[model samples]
Target: MNIELWWPKLTPSTRVGLLENNGDAVPPQVVAEVTRAGGSAAIDSDSEESDYYLSDEDVEWIETVTNEEEPTEGLILSKVRRT
Candidate 1:
């Protein structure tokens, strides 16, 4: 499953965790769930073969789901420039 496909199924807390941790520090259960959903590669930042950078739509969805106004200065998403 693509991140876009599995993302909406994630619990709010799980989504917030991903946003807060910048794709790092994912809980093992969440990882397992993502793997089951075929999105394991999407969270593996260390995998050279992984092309899992967040898209603009992903960022928008995160903000909307989390009710965040915008990426703050210290948020990792703030540094991501989706082209």
Candidate 2:
């Protein structure tokens, strides 16, 4: 599977260097997901990222990565305990 990266949106004060500079470019969840799925991802920092994003599947995986305290698949149900 070919994965495309959507760089994170730049904040108002984020403009610090040349527009083409990949150094300050934000890494999106696409990079993580592609890696997690056992595939390689290509970064296209020049491309535009939309304000609206994150499909259902994308959201779930992003959460898993941010919350490093838990594993991805078992994360959700692991928190729910029987009363």
Candidate 3:
């Protein structure tokens, strides 16, 4: 599955700058869980879609506080997959 992770703030996190800030990274445990469930995880700085697909549990976690209730029309987000 294609997952889009929204980058709320633009900072520098990874060596390649894939993530803006290390503080905004998704939890490792979450990645492990997704992998264990036969899925892959990747981080993205930009995504175009508004809707996403993931397990119900993960979905619940995804729709958490972005600190900004305002909509992000063109901001980038992370992406995960179920391999």
lDDT of 1 by residue, 1-83 (tens): 43556665666666666666553445667677656665653444556653444544555555643554543433333222232
> Tens digit of lDDT per residue, candidate 2, span 39-74?
433444446753223333444444443343443444
How do the candidates rank by lDDT, highest first? 1, 3, 2
Q: Which candidate is the best by TM-score?
A: 1
Q: Quick one: ranking by TM-score, best first?
A: 1, 3, 2
lDDT of all predictions: 0.53, 0.34, 0.36
Collision pairs in model 2 = none
Per-candidate TM equals 0.45, 0.25, 0.25
Candidate 2 vs 3: which has more lDDT = 3
1 or 2, greater by lDDT? 1
lDDT of 2 at 36: 58
Query: Could you tell which candidate, 1 or 2, scores higher by TM-score?
Result: 1
Winning model by lDDT: 1
Q: What local lDDT does model 2 show for residue 43? A: 44
